[model samples]
Target: MTAAVRPPYRVGIVGCGAISRNHLEAFAALPEAVVVAVCDVDADRARSTAERWGIEHAYGSVEELLAAGVDVVSVCTPHPTHEAVVLASAAAGAHVLCEKPIATDLAAAERMVAACDAAGVRLGVLFQRRFWPAAQRLRAAVDDGTLGRPILGHASVLLHREPEYFSSAAWRGTWASDGGGVLMTQAIHYIDLLQWLMGEAVEVHGHIGTFRHAIEVEDSATAVLKFASGAMATLSASTAASPSLGISIRITGETGATAELSEFPEGTDGRVTIWARGGAIESEQVHPADVDPNVDLAAINGQLIPHHTAQVRDFVSALSANDGTGREPAITGSDATAALRILLAVYESSRTGSPVRLNQTATQEALA
Candidate 1:
């Protein structure tokens, strides 16, 4: 007797918003995955999206889609709604791929991770930049001790957001909906990369304020982080800049090893520079011929599709390797929570006007 051949993983998307289009495009590019269904609160939107994507089924609710039996569910809904959908998907015995900032609230994020654990399903989060070649090389250097004794790191995510940017989306700049302004929504990808490159943030001293935008959340924020590896980092994020500076990051070590990268909209390509001992330096300028030099915000997805598709392929491969023996995905639910924990700590520090410590108990003394 021969073993049975498993079919490609079936994926159902729960939101038909703008970001879902990126997810749909990524799925379409992969042969190991299929967009079996799509769901949205708006029936017309769901049907239209399904028609546009050539998907077979469209539903007005996640329940209907889950009943249709998808092997994986992509939760592209609002940030606050992720917990409920993830819980439901886990209950249905389907793996979940959640968007960034897993949940708006810490308690909710904890519950979502726990529920997935109990239900025995894999949860992968979309932090696509980690799959970038430059980021991988930097991480490898840090892990292999090439960047010995991490000393300092600087990460900046500066972009421009007009009034229409916030007014266009109901949850664009709200703490309750989008989590936080520049740090949570815009700079999160870099924040995740920073933490992954350095180590866990053990202490955070931060401040946040809405300087330019009229929205409820802060449009600009800054933080100083102390990592578990004894590394110190400074981070700044703002959306008030006139032109998008893209992401700039530099990590320096005590042994003359440095890794720096810069990405700007005006530049033809993003650049990464790495240097180690003995005066040897290497750099790569990544300018894909297909991407334009003046890539607009909407068109940015065209450049990111490869990274997103790579993540999806990794997720599908992880699922295939799971022979009912509880193997973890490349990016697990807890792994996604790591960055969220630091961001939450930053918010807490800003609110209390004091430094915040994470994953550790501190001795408190009563004021005289």
Candidate 2:
């Protein structure tokens, strides 16, 4: 007798944006998954994306995509629109993997999480950077006490974006559409990574300004965070750096050990740039030397396909093992909310000129 082979999960992609390509490519690479359909408000784009990817179906709305059937949905819509798509997908009993920052506000995120839980569906938020080798090593170090009792952390995300970057998309730099600027859009990834390694944030003090960009949202932001485990961290991010410096995160442990992950030239794999313990210190350069500094943003985003593929693979594995003994997604909706909560608190603190505490009431009040 031969063992049975399971059929691949039917995956549906919502939103045919630049980031959607990442999701599509990620799913296309997984043999255990097949993108059966695609949907977008712009029916033409959806049709084109489907045709380009050789998918069989495309629709103008989520309802049509759900009607066509799917086992999983990858939500690639804007930050503010994620909640609706996630809720609808969960209602249709399909597991959802969403782009980061879960939603524009914490309340929406909580509702989406609750809906997924009630529907008995899994909800994953994409923080693909978490899948980076260097990120994994740092997380392992924290978990195994290699960096015993992390006492301090820092993330610097200084990158350049031409004014055209925002002007190109109607929703790019608007609070109403995109949710926020640097802190909400770009830094949220590093914030998620920071909170993931530092445990939980208890308080936040921050400031924001539209230093250079001619947009309604702030182009720059700075914040300090206190974690529940008595660890402290600082975050400074901006789209204002000329010629684009890359992003870096550093962690210092009470055991007198320190490690740093640096992603230089932007949109590249980060490496453990510095690791110091006792009398030993080491550094490794991961990205290519002589790389162009002014690569197009779309090209930069394309570099993240590998990490996206890694996370999508995990999502498929979890769904495939639905026999009650499967591992959950690494970045669940609840796990993602932690970073959103911290960043929202930063926004509130910056507005009110006071340190904001992290709690349900505080979060609700901040959004209110």
- Highest-scoring model, TM-score: 2
Q: After superposition, how far is residue 163 of candidate 1 from its true place, in Å?
A: 1.6
lDDT of 2 by residue, 257-293 (tens): 9999998878888889999987899977634567766
Lowest-scoring 10 consecutive residues by lDDT in candidate 1? 359-368
lDDT of 1 by residue, 164-221 (tens): 8788878788877787888887777788888888777778999988888898988888
Report lDDT per candidate.
0.79, 0.88
TM-scores, one per candidate: 0.90, 0.94
